[model samples]
Target: MDVVMRIEQTLDGALSEAEGAGAPPGLAAAMRHAVFPGGARIRPRLCLAVARACGAEDFSAAAATAASIELLHCASLVHDDLPCFDDAPVRRGKPSVHRAFGEPLAVLAGDALIVLAFETLARHAAACPERLATLLLCVGRSVGMPFGIVAGQAWESEPRVDLARYHRAKTGALFAAATVGGAAAAGVESAPWRCLGEKIGEAFQVADDIRDVAGDPDELGKPVGRDAALGRMSAARELGIDGALDRLDLLIGEAAESIPRCPGAAELRALIRLEAQRFLPKELVRVAA
Candidate 1:
Protein backbone atom coordinates (compact mmCIF):
# COMPACT_ATOMS: atom_id res chain seq x y z
CA MET A 1 0.00 0.00 0.00
CA ASP A 2 0.97 3.61 -0.52
CA VAL A 3 2.04 5.79 2.39
CA VAL A 4 -1.18 7.79 2.51
CA MET A 5 -3.36 4.72 2.24
CA ARG A 6 -1.39 2.83 4.85
CA ILE A 7 -1.51 5.76 7.21
CA GLU A 8 -5.24 6.30 6.82
CA GLN A 9 -5.97 2.61 7.17
CA THR A 10 -3.86 2.23 10.28
CA LEU A 11 -5.42 5.33 11.80
CA ASP A 12 -8.94 4.24 11.01
CA GLY A 13 -8.33 0.76 12.35
CA ALA A 14 -6.89 2.09 15.57
CA LEU A 15 -9.84 4.40 16.16
CA SER A 16 -12.37 1.79 15.11
CA GLU A 17 -11.22 -0.52 17.85
CA ALA A 18 -12.85 1.90 20.30
CA GLU A 19 -16.19 2.22 18.59
CA GLY A 20 -19.21 0.53 20.18
CA ALA A 21 -16.91 -1.17 22.61
CA GLY A 22 -17.59 -0.99 26.35
CA ALA A 23 -16.76 2.73 26.12
CA PRO A 24 -19.53 5.31 26.08
CA PRO A 25 -20.89 6.01 22.64
CA GLY A 26 -20.49 9.73 22.99
CA LEU A 27 -16.84 9.45 24.04
CA ALA A 28 -16.10 7.13 21.17
CA ALA A 29 -17.75 9.50 18.74
CA ALA A 30 -15.81 12.45 20.12
CA MET A 31 -12.53 10.60 19.65
CA ARG A 32 -13.47 9.93 16.06
CA HIS A 33 -14.28 13.57 15.53
CA ALA A 34 -10.88 14.70 16.75
CA VAL A 35 -9.09 12.23 14.50
CA PHE A 36 -10.98 12.19 11.25
CA PRO A 37 -10.55 14.95 8.73
CA GLY A 38 -6.94 15.25 9.74
CA GLY A 39 -4.89 18.10 8.44
CA ALA A 40 -1.58 17.61 6.59
CA ARG A 41 -0.79 14.33 8.40
CA ILE A 42 2.75 15.58 8.05
CA ARG A 43 4.13 14.04 11.21
CA PRO A 44 3.06 10.50 10.39
CA ARG A 45 4.03 10.92 6.77
CA LEU A 46 7.49 11.93 7.87
CA CYS A 47 7.60 8.88 10.15
CA LEU A 48 6.87 6.50 7.32
CA ALA A 49 9.17 8.41 5.01
CA VAL A 50 12.07 8.10 7.41
CA ALA A 51 11.32 4.42 7.92
CA ARG A 52 11.49 3.84 4.18
CA ALA A 53 14.62 5.92 3.80
CA CYS A 54 16.17 3.57 6.37
CA GLY A 55 14.93 0.51 4.46
CA ALA A 56 12.32 -0.62 6.94
CA GLU A 57 11.62 -4.33 6.41
CA ASP A 58 8.76 -4.65 8.84
CA PHE A 59 6.01 -2.61 7.24
CA SER A 60 3.49 -3.34 9.98
CA ALA A 61 5.69 -1.89 12.67
CA ALA A 62 6.43 1.19 10.60
CA ALA A 63 2.74 1.76 9.89
CA ALA A 64 1.92 1.43 13.56
CA THR A 65 4.63 3.91 14.45
CA ALA A 66 3.21 6.38 11.93
CA ALA A 67 -0.32 5.95 13.24
CA SER A 68 0.85 6.35 16.81
CA ILE A 69 2.58 9.63 16.03
CA GLU A 70 -0.49 10.93 14.24
CA LEU A 71 -2.77 9.99 17.13
CA LEU A 72 -0.60 11.91 19.60
CA HIS A 73 -0.67 14.84 17.22
CA CYS A 74 -4.45 14.69 17.02
CA ALA A 75 -4.72 14.49 20.78
CA SER A 76 -2.50 17.53 21.12
CA LEU A 77 -4.66 19.48 18.71
CA VAL A 78 -7.76 18.54 20.67
CA HIS A 79 -6.22 19.85 23.85
CA ASP A 80 -4.62 22.87 22.22
CA ASP A 81 -8.00 24.05 20.96
CA LEU A 82 -9.61 23.86 24.38
CA PRO A 83 -10.77 26.94 26.29
CA CYS A 84 -7.67 26.79 28.45
CA PHE A 85 -5.32 26.83 25.48
CA ASP A 86 -5.67 28.46 22.09
CA ASP A 87 -9.43 28.28 22.61
CA ALA A 88 -10.03 28.65 18.94
CA PRO A 89 -13.47 27.99 17.48
CA VAL A 90 -12.46 26.17 14.34
CA ARG A 91 -9.90 23.52 13.40
CA ARG A 92 -9.28 22.12 9.96
CA GLY A 93 -12.15 24.40 8.88
CA LYS A 94 -14.63 22.78 11.26
CA PRO A 95 -15.77 23.23 14.83
CA SER A 96 -13.19 22.08 17.33
CA VAL A 97 -13.83 19.08 19.63
CA HIS A 98 -14.81 21.30 22.53
CA ARG A 99 -17.19 23.22 20.32
CA ALA A 100 -18.72 20.10 18.82
CA PHE A 101 -18.79 18.03 21.95
CA GLY A 102 -18.50 19.53 25.44
CA GLU A 103 -15.24 20.52 27.09
CA PRO A 104 -15.46 17.55 29.48
CA LEU A 105 -15.80 15.07 26.67
CA ALA A 106 -13.18 16.86 24.67
CA VAL A 107 -10.73 16.42 27.48
CA LEU A 108 -11.57 12.75 27.84
CA ALA A 109 -11.31 12.30 24.10
CA GLY A 110 -7.82 13.74 23.98
CA ASP A 111 -6.76 11.63 26.92
CA ALA A 112 -8.20 8.53 25.35
CA LEU A 113 -6.41 9.18 22.10
CA ILE A 114 -3.14 9.49 23.95
CA VAL A 115 -3.67 6.10 25.51
CA LEU A 116 -4.72 4.68 22.20
CA ALA A 117 -1.48 5.83 20.63
CA PHE A 118 0.51 3.72 23.02
CA GLU A 119 -1.82 0.79 22.62
CA THR A 120 -1.41 0.90 18.87
CA LEU A 121 2.34 0.78 19.18
CA ALA A 122 2.20 -2.01 21.73
CA ARG A 123 0.19 -4.23 19.44
CA HIS A 124 2.98 -4.15 16.89
CA ALA A 125 5.84 -4.47 19.34
CA ALA A 126 6.24 -8.17 18.82
CA ALA A 127 7.21 -7.53 15.24
CA CYS A 128 10.49 -6.13 16.53
CA PRO A 129 10.84 -6.51 20.27
CA GLU A 130 14.43 -5.36 20.26
CA ARG A 131 13.42 -1.96 18.96
CA LEU A 132 10.06 -1.57 20.73
CA ALA A 133 11.65 -0.03 23.81
CA THR A 134 13.29 2.67 21.76
CA LEU A 135 10.06 3.46 19.89
CA LEU A 136 8.12 3.76 23.13
CA LEU A 137 10.74 6.04 24.62
CA CYS A 138 10.70 8.33 21.63
CA VAL A 139 6.91 8.64 21.64
CA GLY A 140 6.65 8.96 25.42
CA ARG A 141 9.29 11.66 25.66
CA SER A 142 7.64 13.57 22.85
CA VAL A 143 4.33 13.69 24.68
CA GLY A 144 5.48 14.20 28.26
CA MET A 145 8.33 15.81 29.90
CA PRO A 146 11.11 18.05 30.73
CA PHE A 147 11.34 18.32 26.96
CA GLY A 148 8.04 17.63 25.28
CA ILE A 149 4.79 19.22 24.20
CA VAL A 150 3.55 19.24 27.79
CA ALA A 151 6.57 21.28 28.81
CA GLY A 152 6.06 23.49 25.83
CA GLN A 153 2.54 24.27 27.03
CA ALA A 154 3.69 24.75 30.61
CA TRP A 155 6.24 27.32 29.48
CA GLU A 156 3.40 29.63 28.58
CA SER A 157 2.45 29.72 32.25
CA GLU A 158 5.99 30.63 33.34
CA PRO A 159 7.18 34.23 33.84
CA ARG A 160 10.17 33.69 31.55
CA VAL A 161 10.54 31.38 28.59
CA ASP A 162 13.26 30.22 26.25
CA LEU A 163 11.76 30.77 22.83
CA ALA A 164 13.76 28.13 20.97
CA ARG A 165 13.34 25.50 23.65
CA TYR A 166 9.64 26.26 23.97
CA HIS A 167 9.12 26.01 20.25
CA ARG A 168 11.12 22.78 20.01
CA ALA A 169 9.26 21.08 22.82
CA LYS A 170 5.85 22.36 21.85
CA THR A 171 6.14 21.68 18.16
CA GLY A 172 9.46 20.06 17.49
CA ALA A 173 9.31 17.17 19.93
CA LEU A 174 6.82 15.12 17.95
CA PHE A 175 8.60 15.82 14.71
CA ALA A 176 11.75 14.52 16.31
CA ALA A 177 9.88 11.49 17.59
CA ALA A 178 8.46 10.83 14.14
CA THR A 179 11.89 10.70 12.54
CA VAL A 180 13.63 8.97 15.37
CA GLY A 181 10.83 6.51 15.95
CA GLY A 182 10.77 5.70 12.28
CA ALA A 183 14.42 4.76 12.26
CA ALA A 184 14.19 2.94 15.57
CA ALA A 185 11.17 0.97 14.39
CA ALA A 186 13.36 -0.34 11.61
CA GLY A 187 16.03 -1.26 14.14
CA VAL A 188 18.32 1.36 12.68
CA GLU A 189 20.35 3.97 14.53
CA SER A 190 18.28 7.12 14.84
CA ALA A 191 20.72 9.79 16.03
CA PRO A 192 21.60 10.85 12.52
CA TRP A 193 17.93 11.62 11.83
CA ARG A 194 17.55 13.98 14.79
CA CYS A 195 18.81 17.15 13.14
CA LEU A 196 16.50 16.76 10.19
CA GLY A 197 13.44 16.44 12.40
CA GLU A 198 14.37 19.32 14.71
CA LYS A 199 15.08 21.68 11.84
CA ILE A 200 11.85 20.73 10.07
CA GLY A 201 9.87 21.18 13.26
CA GLU A 202 11.40 24.60 13.90
CA ALA A 203 10.72 25.66 10.32
CA PHE A 204 7.13 24.52 10.66
CA GLN A 205 6.77 26.53 13.88
CA VAL A 206 8.10 29.67 12.20
CA ALA A 207 5.74 29.14 9.29
CA ASP A 208 2.90 28.86 11.79
CA ASP A 209 4.04 32.09 13.41
CA ILE A 210 4.02 33.83 10.04
CA ARG A 211 0.62 32.44 9.14
CA ASP A 212 -0.92 33.54 12.43
CA VAL A 213 0.16 37.09 11.70
CA ALA A 214 -0.65 37.45 8.01
CA GLY A 215 -2.51 34.37 6.86
CA ASP A 216 -6.19 34.27 6.05
CA PRO A 217 -8.18 32.27 8.60
CA ASP A 218 -10.25 30.78 5.82
CA GLU A 219 -7.15 29.66 4.00
CA LEU A 220 -5.52 28.41 7.19
CA GLY A 221 -8.66 26.61 8.43
CA LYS A 222 -8.25 28.24 11.84
CA PRO A 223 -8.23 31.62 13.48
CA VAL A 224 -5.25 33.80 12.58
CA GLY A 225 -3.55 36.54 14.60
CA ARG A 226 -3.69 34.34 17.67
CA ASP A 227 -0.13 34.95 18.86
CA ALA A 228 -0.68 38.63 19.55
CA ALA A 229 -4.19 38.08 20.83
CA LEU A 230 -2.93 35.52 23.33
CA GLY A 231 0.22 37.56 24.11
CA ARG A 232 2.32 34.59 23.14
CA MET A 233 5.95 34.85 22.06
CA SER A 234 6.31 34.25 18.35
CA ALA A 235 8.94 34.67 15.70
CA ALA A 236 6.69 37.00 13.74
CA ARG A 237 6.00 39.07 16.86
CA GLU A 238 9.60 39.11 18.11
CA LEU A 239 11.42 39.29 14.80
CA GLY A 240 8.83 41.04 12.63
CA ILE A 241 7.10 39.44 9.66
CA ASP A 242 9.96 39.97 7.21
CA GLY A 243 12.52 38.71 9.67
CA ALA A 244 10.46 35.66 10.53
CA LEU A 245 10.12 34.96 6.84
CA ASP A 246 13.87 35.08 6.48
CA ARG A 247 14.28 32.76 9.45
CA LEU A 248 11.75 30.34 8.00
CA ASP A 249 13.62 30.17 4.69
CA LEU A 250 16.86 29.63 6.54
CA LEU A 251 15.40 26.77 8.59
CA ILE A 252 13.92 25.12 5.55
CA GLY A 253 17.27 25.20 3.80
CA GLU A 254 18.99 23.88 6.88
CA ALA A 255 16.44 21.07 7.21
CA ALA A 256 17.13 19.91 3.67
CA GLU A 257 20.88 19.91 4.27
CA SER A 258 20.51 18.05 7.58
CA ILE A 259 19.08 14.90 6.02
CA PRO A 260 21.42 11.97 6.78
CA ARG A 261 22.84 9.93 3.97
CA CYS A 262 20.33 7.25 3.08
CA PRO A 263 19.14 5.16 0.17
CA GLY A 264 16.35 7.61 -0.64
CA ALA A 265 18.05 10.79 0.54
CA ALA A 266 17.53 12.62 -2.75
CA GLU A 267 13.85 11.78 -2.85
CA LEU A 268 13.39 12.90 0.75
CA ARG A 269 15.13 16.19 0.04
CA ALA A 270 12.82 16.80 -2.88
CA LEU A 271 9.84 16.03 -0.71
CA ILE A 272 10.98 18.56 1.88
CA ARG A 273 11.41 21.23 -0.79
CA LEU A 274 7.97 20.47 -2.20
CA GLU A 275 6.33 20.73 1.21
CA ALA A 276 8.19 23.98 1.91
CA GLN A 277 6.93 25.47 -1.31
CA ARG A 278 3.44 24.33 -0.50
CA PHE A 279 3.40 25.53 3.10
CA LEU A 280 5.50 28.70 2.94
CA PRO A 281 3.57 31.91 2.39
CA LYS A 282 3.79 32.92 -1.25
CA GLU A 283 3.88 36.58 -0.26
CA LEU A 284 6.92 35.96 1.91
CA VAL A 285 8.67 34.05 -0.84
CA ARG A 286 7.94 36.82 -3.34
CA VAL A 287 9.15 39.58 -1.03
CA ALA A 288 12.55 38.04 -0.23
CA ALA A 289 15.34 39.58 -2.31
Candidate 2:
Protein backbone atom coordinates (compact mmCIF):
# COMPACT_ATOMS: atom_id res chain seq x y z
CA MET A 1 0.00 0.00 0.00
CA ASP A 2 1.04 3.61 -0.51
CA VAL A 3 2.27 5.51 2.50
CA VAL A 4 -0.78 7.73 2.91
CA MET A 5 -3.16 4.86 2.41
CA ARG A 6 -1.26 2.73 4.84
CA ILE A 7 -1.47 5.42 7.50
CA GLU A 8 -5.19 6.05 6.98
CA GLN A 9 -6.02 2.36 7.01
CA THR A 10 -4.16 1.79 10.23
CA LEU A 11 -5.80 4.80 11.85
CA ASP A 12 -9.24 3.76 10.64
CA GLY A 13 -8.75 0.27 11.97
CA ALA A 14 -7.58 1.62 15.29
CA LEU A 15 -10.64 3.83 15.54
CA SER A 16 -12.81 0.89 14.68
CA GLU A 17 -11.42 -1.03 17.56
CA ALA A 18 -11.85 2.02 19.74
CA GLU A 19 -15.50 2.40 18.76
CA GLY A 20 -16.46 -1.22 19.16
CA ALA A 21 -19.46 -2.50 21.12
CA GLY A 22 -19.93 -1.01 24.62
CA ALA A 23 -17.74 2.00 23.75
CA PRO A 24 -19.16 5.38 24.63
CA PRO A 25 -20.68 6.82 21.47
CA GLY A 26 -19.82 10.41 22.28
CA LEU A 27 -16.19 9.67 23.06
CA ALA A 28 -15.83 7.48 19.99
CA ALA A 29 -17.29 10.13 17.74
CA ALA A 30 -15.16 12.83 19.25
CA MET A 31 -12.01 10.74 18.85
CA ARG A 32 -12.89 9.89 15.28
CA HIS A 33 -13.45 13.55 14.50
CA ALA A 34 -10.05 14.44 15.85
CA VAL A 35 -8.25 11.92 13.61
CA PHE A 36 -10.01 11.85 10.29
CA PRO A 37 -9.15 14.34 7.56
CA GLY A 38 -5.86 14.95 9.27
CA GLY A 39 -3.53 17.74 8.40
CA ALA A 40 -0.45 16.94 6.26
CA ARG A 41 0.02 13.69 8.28
CA ILE A 42 3.65 14.70 8.41
CA ARG A 43 4.65 12.95 11.62
CA PRO A 44 3.29 9.59 10.56
CA ARG A 45 4.66 10.04 7.05
CA LEU A 46 8.02 10.88 8.56
CA CYS A 47 7.84 7.64 10.53
CA LEU A 48 7.26 5.72 7.30
CA ALA A 49 10.07 7.53 5.49
CA VAL A 50 12.59 6.77 8.19
CA ALA A 51 11.59 3.12 8.21
CA ARG A 52 11.82 2.85 4.44
CA ALA A 53 15.17 4.56 4.44
CA CYS A 54 16.33 1.98 6.95
CA GLY A 55 15.42 -0.75 4.45
CA ALA A 56 12.19 -1.90 6.00
CA GLU A 57 10.13 -3.92 3.53
CA ASP A 58 7.61 -5.24 6.04
CA PHE A 59 5.85 -2.02 6.97
CA SER A 60 3.56 -3.40 9.66
CA ALA A 61 5.73 -2.09 12.46
CA ALA A 62 6.40 1.17 10.69
CA ALA A 63 2.74 1.68 9.84
CA ALA A 64 1.65 0.94 13.39
CA THR A 65 4.23 3.30 14.80
CA ALA A 66 3.18 5.94 12.31
CA ALA A 67 -0.44 5.59 13.34
CA SER A 68 0.52 5.77 16.97
CA ILE A 69 2.46 8.98 16.49
CA GLU A 70 -0.34 10.53 14.47
CA LEU A 71 -2.88 9.58 17.13
CA LEU A 72 -0.81 11.23 19.82
CA HIS A 73 -0.47 14.29 17.63
CA CYS A 74 -4.23 14.44 17.17
CA ALA A 75 -4.70 14.05 20.89
CA SER A 76 -2.33 16.91 21.55
CA LEU A 77 -4.29 19.06 19.16
CA VAL A 78 -7.53 18.24 20.88
CA HIS A 79 -6.15 19.33 24.22
CA ASP A 80 -4.24 22.27 22.81
CA ASP A 81 -7.45 23.74 21.46
CA LEU A 82 -9.26 23.47 24.76
CA PRO A 83 -10.14 26.78 26.45
CA CYS A 84 -7.37 26.08 28.93
CA PHE A 85 -4.76 26.16 26.18
CA ASP A 86 -4.90 27.85 22.80
CA ASP A 87 -8.70 27.74 23.00
CA ALA A 88 -8.74 27.59 19.25
CA PRO A 89 -12.23 27.57 17.78
CA VAL A 90 -11.18 26.00 14.51
CA ARG A 91 -8.88 23.26 13.33
CA ARG A 92 -8.21 21.94 9.83
CA GLY A 93 -11.04 24.27 8.74
CA LYS A 94 -13.57 22.77 11.12
CA PRO A 95 -14.76 23.46 14.63
CA SER A 96 -12.23 22.51 17.24
CA VAL A 97 -13.03 19.34 19.12
CA HIS A 98 -14.02 21.30 22.21
CA ARG A 99 -16.38 23.38 20.12
CA ALA A 100 -17.84 20.44 18.24
CA PHE A 101 -18.05 17.99 21.13
CA GLY A 102 -17.90 20.40 24.09
CA GLU A 103 -14.98 20.85 26.47
CA PRO A 104 -15.50 17.80 28.73
CA LEU A 105 -15.64 15.41 25.79
CA ALA A 106 -12.80 17.20 24.13
CA VAL A 107 -10.57 16.51 27.11
CA LEU A 108 -11.71 12.91 27.19
CA ALA A 109 -11.16 12.53 23.46
CA GLY A 110 -7.59 13.74 23.82
CA ASP A 111 -6.99 11.30 26.63
CA ALA A 112 -8.60 8.52 24.65
CA LEU A 113 -6.40 9.23 21.67
CA ILE A 114 -3.33 9.10 23.88
CA VAL A 115 -4.32 5.68 25.22
CA LEU A 116 -5.21 4.53 21.72
CA ALA A 117 -1.77 5.46 20.42
CA PHE A 118 -0.11 2.95 22.72
CA GLU A 119 -2.88 0.45 22.15
CA THR A 120 -2.36 0.66 18.40
CA LEU A 121 1.33 0.03 18.90
CA ALA A 122 0.73 -2.87 21.22
CA ARG A 123 -1.86 -4.44 18.98
CA HIS A 124 0.60 -4.53 16.12
CA ALA A 125 3.65 -5.46 18.12
CA ALA A 126 2.48 -8.63 19.83
CA ALA A 127 4.89 -10.68 17.76
CA CYS A 128 7.88 -8.40 18.37
CA PRO A 129 7.74 -7.14 21.92
CA GLU A 130 11.47 -6.43 21.98
CA ARG A 131 11.21 -3.96 19.14
CA LEU A 132 7.93 -2.75 20.57
CA ALA A 133 9.66 -1.94 23.81
CA THR A 134 12.08 0.36 22.06
CA LEU A 135 9.30 2.00 20.08
CA LEU A 136 7.25 2.49 23.23
CA LEU A 137 10.12 4.16 25.03
CA CYS A 138 10.87 6.37 22.04
CA VAL A 139 7.22 7.28 21.69
CA GLY A 140 6.90 7.92 25.39
CA ARG A 141 9.83 10.31 25.46
CA SER A 142 8.35 12.22 22.54
CA VAL A 143 5.14 13.16 24.33
CA GLY A 144 5.88 12.79 28.03
CA MET A 145 7.54 14.93 30.65
CA PRO A 146 10.98 16.59 30.97
CA PHE A 147 11.82 16.50 27.27
CA GLY A 148 8.65 15.50 25.50
CA ILE A 149 5.83 17.53 23.97
CA VAL A 150 4.20 17.52 27.39
CA ALA A 151 7.29 19.15 28.79
CA GLY A 152 7.22 21.48 25.87
CA GLN A 153 3.71 22.48 26.81
CA ALA A 154 4.66 22.72 30.44
CA TRP A 155 7.44 25.09 29.54
CA GLU A 156 4.79 27.65 28.84
CA SER A 157 3.71 27.47 32.47
CA GLU A 158 7.14 28.33 33.73
CA PRO A 159 7.98 31.93 34.53
CA ARG A 160 11.13 31.60 32.43
CA VAL A 161 12.03 29.22 29.60
CA ASP A 162 14.83 28.48 27.17
CA LEU A 163 13.92 28.82 23.53
CA ALA A 164 15.87 25.77 22.40
CA ARG A 165 14.48 23.57 25.15
CA TYR A 166 10.97 24.84 24.58
CA HIS A 167 11.15 24.34 20.84
CA ARG A 168 12.76 20.91 21.18
CA ALA A 169 10.22 19.64 23.66
CA LYS A 170 7.08 21.23 22.28
CA THR A 171 7.68 20.89 18.56
CA GLY A 172 10.81 18.87 17.99
CA ALA A 173 10.00 16.01 20.33
CA LEU A 174 7.54 14.22 18.08
CA PHE A 175 9.70 14.66 15.03
CA ALA A 176 12.51 13.02 16.94
CA ALA A 177 10.14 10.27 17.99
CA ALA A 178 9.01 9.80 14.39
CA THR A 179 12.55 9.34 13.18
CA VAL A 180 13.75 7.29 16.10
CA GLY A 181 10.55 5.27 16.25
CA GLY A 182 10.82 4.57 12.54
CA ALA A 183 14.34 3.29 13.05
CA ALA A 184 13.24 1.14 15.94
CA ALA A 185 10.38 -0.23 13.86
CA ALA A 186 12.87 -1.24 11.18
CA GLY A 187 15.16 -2.84 13.79
CA VAL A 188 17.85 -0.17 13.25
CA GLU A 189 19.78 1.29 16.15
CA SER A 190 17.60 4.32 16.70
CA ALA A 191 19.84 6.70 18.65
CA PRO A 192 21.98 8.01 15.79
CA TRP A 193 18.84 9.12 13.98
CA ARG A 194 17.91 11.62 16.70
CA CYS A 195 19.78 14.60 15.29
CA LEU A 196 17.97 14.37 11.96
CA GLY A 197 14.56 14.35 13.58
CA GLU A 198 15.53 17.14 16.00
CA LYS A 199 16.70 19.30 13.15
CA ILE A 200 13.56 18.65 11.15
CA GLY A 201 11.40 19.33 14.19
CA GLU A 202 13.25 22.56 14.87
CA ALA A 203 12.89 23.57 11.24
CA PHE A 204 9.20 22.78 11.31
CA GLN A 205 8.78 24.95 14.44
CA VAL A 206 10.51 27.82 12.70
CA ALA A 207 8.21 27.39 9.72
CA ASP A 208 5.20 27.45 12.05
CA ASP A 209 6.51 30.59 13.73
CA ILE A 210 6.80 32.22 10.35
CA ARG A 211 3.26 31.21 9.48
CA ASP A 212 1.91 32.47 12.79
CA VAL A 213 3.16 35.92 11.87
CA ALA A 214 2.63 36.06 8.10
CA GLY A 215 0.12 33.37 7.22
CA ASP A 216 -3.55 34.03 6.58
CA PRO A 217 -6.11 32.58 8.97
CA ASP A 218 -7.97 30.92 6.09
CA GLU A 219 -4.84 29.30 4.76
CA LEU A 220 -3.50 28.21 8.15
CA GLY A 221 -6.92 27.02 9.36
CA LYS A 222 -6.35 28.41 12.88
CA PRO A 223 -5.41 31.52 14.76
CA VAL A 224 -2.27 33.44 13.88
CA GLY A 225 -0.36 35.72 16.26
CA ARG A 226 -0.93 33.06 18.92
CA ASP A 227 2.63 33.29 20.19
CA ALA A 228 2.31 36.96 20.90
CA ALA A 229 -1.21 36.55 22.22
CA LEU A 230 -0.16 33.79 24.59
CA GLY A 231 3.18 35.34 25.50
CA ARG A 232 5.06 32.42 23.97
CA MET A 233 8.57 32.58 22.56
CA SER A 234 8.97 31.98 18.85
CA ALA A 235 11.49 32.15 16.06
CA ALA A 236 9.69 35.00 14.35
CA ARG A 237 9.75 36.85 17.62
CA GLU A 238 13.42 36.11 18.32
CA LEU A 239 14.84 36.34 14.82
CA GLY A 240 13.69 38.97 12.39
CA ILE A 241 11.56 37.72 9.49
CA ASP A 242 14.63 37.59 7.24
CA GLY A 243 16.67 35.96 9.98
CA ALA A 244 14.03 33.35 10.72
CA LEU A 245 13.83 32.49 7.05
CA ASP A 246 17.59 32.13 6.96
CA ARG A 247 17.49 29.96 10.07
CA LEU A 248 14.89 27.74 8.46
CA ASP A 249 17.10 27.23 5.45
CA LEU A 250 20.08 26.39 7.61
CA LEU A 251 18.10 23.90 9.72
CA ILE A 252 16.71 22.16 6.65
CA GLY A 253 20.23 21.75 5.32
CA GLU A 254 21.39 20.47 8.67
CA ALA A 255 18.48 18.03 8.79
CA ALA A 256 19.33 16.73 5.33
CA GLU A 257 22.95 16.36 6.30
CA SER A 258 22.13 14.57 9.54
CA ILE A 259 20.97 11.41 7.80
CA PRO A 260 22.86 8.65 9.57
CA ARG A 261 24.69 6.72 6.87
CA CYS A 262 21.57 4.81 6.03
CA PRO A 263 21.12 2.71 2.91
CA GLY A 264 18.76 5.33 1.49
CA ALA A 265 20.77 8.34 2.59
CA ALA A 266 20.69 10.14 -0.76
CA GLU A 267 16.97 9.56 -1.22
CA LEU A 268 16.26 10.78 2.34
CA ARG A 269 18.19 13.99 1.69
CA ALA A 270 16.14 14.56 -1.45
CA LEU A 271 12.99 14.04 0.58
CA ILE A 272 14.11 16.62 3.16
CA ARG A 273 14.86 19.15 0.42
CA LEU A 274 11.45 18.55 -1.10
CA GLU A 275 9.67 18.96 2.24
CA ALA A 276 11.59 22.17 2.87
CA GLN A 277 9.92 23.64 -0.18
CA ARG A 278 6.50 22.74 1.18
CA PHE A 279 7.31 24.24 4.60
CA LEU A 280 7.76 27.72 3.21
CA PRO A 281 5.32 27.85 0.34
CA LYS A 282 6.22 30.08 -2.60
CA GLU A 283 3.85 32.90 -1.68
CA LEU A 284 5.02 32.87 1.93
CA VAL A 285 8.59 32.86 0.74
CA ARG A 286 7.91 35.97 -1.28
CA VAL A 287 6.00 37.65 1.54
CA ALA A 288 8.34 36.76 4.36
CA ALA A 289 11.52 37.37 2.45
What's the TM for model 1? 0.95
Backbone clashes for every candidate come to 0, 0
lDDT of 1 by residue, 1-289 (tens): 8889999999999998877458798899899999888888999999998888888777888899999999999998999999998887899998999999999999999999999999999988887877777888899999899998889989988988988889999999999998898888877889888889999999899888888888888878898888888888788888998898788878888988898888888898888877776565566654322
lDDT (Cα atoms) of all candidates against the true structure: 0.88, 0.90
Q: Estimate TM-scores for all models.
A: 0.95, 0.96
- Candidate 1: segments with Cα more than 4 A from true spot: 282-289
Per-residue lDDT for 77 in model 1?
Answer: 91
Instruction: Report how far residue 111 has shifted in candidate 2, in Å.
Output: 0.6
